[model samples]
Target chain A: MDNKTLEQLKEKANIIRKDIINMLAEAKSGHPGGSLSAVEILTYLYFKEMNVDPTNPQWPDRDRFVLSKGHGAPVLYAVLAEKGYFSKEELMKLRKTGAMLQGHPDMKGTPGVEMSTGSLGQGLSASNGMALAGKLDNKNYRVYVLVGDGEMQEGQIWEAAMTAAHYKLDNLTAFVDNNGLQIDGTNEDVKNVEPIEDKWKAFGWHVITIDGHDFQQIENAVKEAKETKGKPTAIIAKTVKGKGVSFMENQVDWHGVAPNEEQKEKALKELEVRI
Target chain B: MANIATREAYGAALAELGEKYQDVVVLDADLSKSTKTSEFKKKFPNRFFNIGISEQDLMGTAAGLATCGKIPFASTFAMFATGRAFEQIRNSIAYPNLNVKIAASHAGITLGEDGASHQAIEDIALMRAVPNMTIVNPADALSTKKAVEAAILHKGPMYIRLGRLGVPEVYKEDMDFRIGKGILLEEGKDVTIIACGFMVHIALEASSMLKEEGISAEVIDMHTIKPLDEEIIINSARKTHAVVTAEEHNIIGGLGGAVAEVLCENYPVPMVRVGIKDVFGQSGKPLELVELYGISAKDVAAAAKKAIAKK
Candidate 1:
């Protein structure tokens, strides 16, 4: 992509980060760390990547995305709102009882959501279906699914990985937000997903490791994924949980904890400024 | 009418769905022939996905397709879909409320010769326990078509339980069927006969025999067992003062339990649950096994009278 387009996408991502902070702060609950960490990737997909129609959200043959780790919905919600899938004001409704913006993604209630994901490792399989369908129908659309490092502990993801590889689902690309933190604590403290990239490669995916926060690197990885054929691709993105904000960054406590007013202000400010 | 099994109806409806809705796709777990989706695979080869024998992967794949604006009908035996891949259905499909219609054929004792291993007697209970899942058991080929159509339009994770063997078509082709509503087949004042799937036809036959014996009976095809047409069943039970539930499932956790739980909680009516008496099924012909388990018309009529005696 051109430098101008890249800068604009980054700007859009900052706006999404702002929404994530505001929404989480409003709900007084949610996964802020992972939400913040995934903003860059989410923004890149919604703004600079995926072929989605905000107006016709259910348009068939459109490029699909699955947010496998659904707790980080603040990021996805922000992206969807900005993209006009729903009103931007719906951000305040996040996690409210009976609200369309549920704790996790509800495919029926929300627009532009591919699956109702909150349970981890399952989204990969769903994306595998989309990729397989695209191949079967000979549709040119690509499928992207974002997963959490911690979410990888679930056995279904590997099951999907194996199936996707076996079916040669080249139309699918999965991104692992190596945020290092989960609900209880750090991923390493709980379960070791250390050999994650190798594990995916062994499953027959074309593996690419990149600095997830870097827009250019993410763009390049996505482009390279499209060029590769025969098997699915896995982009192992090393990202900071609760990125952009100083206090929230790398802190496992911030995994699902919402930022208070003061913290939100600081986070919003941090995202507004460059880097 | 032509020995059309409900499983074949599921496949036929899916094949038809593929023709109309380009976004509709079918996923199978290597039992396409058993599930009767092989016909669909033949008609719409591109939309039919064979995910090998992995039931978990099959469910997860269907959920994924639903997210991408595709309506996915996942075909598998009820034993596998609801038993093996239940977590996948709960987590991926029901949890997300994705529009993944699980068309599980070979439900209940009608799976016959396959024994207890292949019989999905507890699927309704397991699938109903999961939040945001719409459970259905269509009695005949026509109702199966309607259930499949309704499930496709329902806009949530759904389970449509169908049988393997051919049963009498109990509904008219023009009969209306909503996803969660029950249809009252016959009206009586002595006992309310509530049944679903294969038992619905049995209930109607039982009610007719009871009528000839001067024992007035109310027959309701309790098709959609989840958001159960409780109002109709409860009203009938209150009016008739007794209820009898029959299914090709176990008495422990199937339509019998689902109905008993609802009735005992709200309306405490004398109810007899006619099905497998908490025992695993043995290999036999579909009809023979159903009759052997007392999930047949004669058994249903006897159970209806037993229930009435309590009242």
Candidate 2:
């Protein structure tokens, strides 16, 4: 990618970070650390990688995405709005009664959401279904899924991993957002999920490790995933929990709690400087 | 009456459905042979998926397939499909209201010789608790085939329970089958014998016995348990004023419980439930298990007599 494109993506990522901070603060309940960490990945997929149309979200041949780590719904909502899936006004009403954006991603109500997901370790299986459908229909559209590193503790994730490889779903790509934090504490202290790349490789996945926040690495990993055939790809991304804001970065306390009005103002000012 | 296992009918129905619907995909968790999905696999090898012994993965993959416009029929033993993978079914399939059909085999104590661990006496109750789920328990092989056809045509989450034991065919192959429609097999004003699954045949036998004893007993095949035929149940309850509910499952939270819930609110008739009396089934022959669990024809007749006496 060129420097100009990289700069544009960076600016978009920072705007998404601001939206996440504001939405969580307004909703008065939601996860921030995980949402912040997943901003760039969601931006890259909705903006550059995926062949999605905001107007015709249900087009059969369009590429699909599943937020497997569904608690990070704010980031997905922000990026979708940025891509014109819905209005930016809907972001503030998230988690409110009768709001289109619920605490979780509801595919029925939300546009550009291929599958409704909040439960962890379940999205990969759905992604495999989409990829298989593409194969069955002879369409070149690919399927992408984003999973949390803490979600690896679920046994179902491994089961889905096995299914993806057993079927030889070369069109499917998975990313483990290795921010290393769970609701309780750090992933290592709560439940060790290390050796992540080796695990996917053993499960017969073509593996790639990259800096999740880096646009060039993100682009390269996706390109590699597309080029590789006959096996699914697992891009293990190393990211910092709460990537943009100074106070929340790498802080376990921000995993699932809304910021106060004063704290939100501070966070927005910090993100604005980057833009 | 022809005798055949409902699981066998389910296998045959899936193969026939594959011929008509090109996008129909079948999945199983190492129980394809027993569940009868192996038949579909044989015909549609390219569309069949055997996810080994992982029921959770089977459900998740089925949900994924449904999202991609494939009508996936995920099959396994009732215990594994409903019990082992309960959360996966609840979150992945039911929550999304996906077009996935879970055709579970070996439901209830009729799956004899497998003992309590394998028998799924609570599968119906477990499935009923989830929203956006349709539950069907066919009385015979013909009804099982019809149930499969109905499930395939209906584009939503469904659970069709089939039994391993051979049951007497209660309906003809050409009988019209619809979801949530109960079949009125026999009619009487003295009492009503409402049954489902293997116990439907027993209920018919009980009705005949009641006739010999100078009592007019009504018999109904309540095939679809959820989205139940409440009109039929309430109308029969009003006429008979007494009821005996029979099923091959536990009395609590199965056919009996469902009937009682409907009648208590609508008609409030005297009722006796003929099923496994809150006990796990031990390994035995199919008929022996049915009798030991107190779900035989004699039990249905006796329960009807008791209900009549109460009235």
Candidate 3:
């Protein structure tokens, strides 16, 4: 809320970005572009917005979060490790056979993951289910999900959007990481997901657009989402593909390719100097 | 013994189960009336969710409910539940080993009139491929009721296939039902006739037909297809030395394929598979379609004889 808190979150985001590079560099294969793009969103949720206990990860009353764009698991794993959900040691062993952190977000293997998600567009529906259960049980805990901009091409997202609005799931807030680039190319080149904000509105969701890297805007949108009633909110977060890194920034080639040793060094150095 | 659709028994059993387990929730993809989850909806309106026609959302939402310590039974036509939402069930429910029961009705050619598009001849094979998924194809009304109760008692993902056509009751009310165990209805030394779903009744009829021929065919109702009753299958195959499997599904990967795999690996018996022969169904009366699809009792009887001859 204040300059000190915002500055602290920014520092935390820088550290998480470095961790993403390091984890991907070690694993030799992962989505670094999307993970870096979603650093601020994950940092803000774990550090400031959400009410979760790392010690009691399965606390029933705790707020739940789903990483809808599950290929961006590096960011989630980094954030969860930072929050002490598991050891920071597990971050390196990601995607390894018999490791706790899977290639995708596995709720059973990972302590902080709310739902197992890798296949796109299914997380919002799972979020709606959790929100519906919360309403049924009369629990005040909210549900949050982060979906990729490219992930919007999935029809299940709209189906879930209709469900959330039809059920009046005010407790559910979704963030669309509009990084504008996918694995193939730019979203425009691959499949235009433009009129994105209007699409969520047409689905009866309260839409809010924000600069994803800005902590203050991310905070305000989450706050407004909580106060809104009778409908769920969709925060369309405009972000750069690979926000903090130099060579990877807005590069389509970085989508699923892990950085080599030299590239990882460059990326980490850039993150260190950015703040 | 009353004739009732397995879906109807499912509806009644779900309503009863809802009263006993307050955490039991039902979700349907706009086919609640057909799926018989409407009965559960009528009993627990607040707990039931009609997820519109979105089968993908239906499965994902059910998986979400399961994470919250609720036993969510997601229902739809078997075609949609396993066919359309295969990935959702795999990644969301089965992958997590979630406590979501997929009670899919209108399975097989017996769904009738809706034709090939609606018939789920490959559902068993699809579900069988997924790890941590337990496939239960119950025969008749009483077994369907017991299957519902067992699904609630069992944790993790389960696919309970039900039928639209009313079938003659093969078991009494107090029949012993277990998730992975098969029931031996009649014992014979010549050949074993293994069947699931509505085919169990046909298998019994085939056994009687074999009796007239002095073949002495054994009848076994293999309700649970996955985590299959391998012991019963191996033991029976060893004694009979011949096996015939009948199912209202594709012979490639249904009860027939499962039985074949067991016998070939463990007991190595002469086996004949009586099923759809890898063809889709056409719109017709249920019994007419059953006969036309080559899954009739006479078909099973002939298959049993063929297996016996091979032995």
Q: Tell me, by DockQ, which candidate is best.
A: 3
Task: Mark the regions of model 3 whose C-alpha exceeds 4 Å error after superposition.
Answer: none
Estimate the TM-score of every prediction.
Answer: 0.85, 0.99, 0.99
lDDT of candidate 3 over A15-100, digit per residue (tens): 89989999999999999999999999999999998999999999999999999999999999999999999999999998999999
Tell me which residue pairs clash in candidate 2. none
Better candidate number, 1 or 3, judged by TM-score: 3
Share of true Cα-Cα contacts across chains kept by each model? 0.83, 0.66, 0.86
Model 2: per-residue lDDT, tens digit, A130-195?
Answer: 887788789999999999999999998999999899999999999999999999999899989988
lDDT of 2 at B138: 92
**Model 2 DockQ, alpha carbons vs. true complex:** 0.76
Could you give candidate 3's per-residue lDDT for residues B62-161 as a string of tens digits? 9988999999999999999999999999999999999999999999999999899999999999999999999999998899989999999999999999
Candidate 1 displacement at residue B22 in angstroms:
5.4
Cα deviation of A81 in candidate 1 (Å)?
3.9
lDDT of 1 at A83: 96
lDDT of 1 by residue, B32-128 (tens): 9889888888998878888888888899998777766678989899999999898899888887677899999998887888788998888888987
Off by over 4 Å in 2: none
Question: What is the C-alpha lDDT profile of model 1 across A1-275, one tens digit per residue?
Answer: 78898889878888888888999999999988899898889999988889999999878878998899988899999999999999988999888987889999888789988877887777888889878767766899999999999988988888888899998988899999998888788888898888988899998999999999999999999999999999889999999988888998999888878888998888888877957
lDDT by candidate, in order shown? 0.87, 0.91, 0.94
- Provide per-model DockQ scores: 0.50, 0.76, 0.90
lDDT of 1 at B39: 84
Better candidate number, 1 or 3, judged by lDDT? 3
Scored by Cα lDDT, where does model 3 land?
A: 0.94
lDDT of 2 by residue, B1-311 (tens): 66899999999988988999898999999999999999999999989999988899899889988988899999999999999999889999999899999999998887889888999988988998899999999988888888888888898999999999888879865787889999999999999999988888899999889899999999999999998999999999889999999988778888889999999898899999988888888788888887787888888899999999999
i-RMS values of the candidates, in order? 2.0, 1.0, 0.5
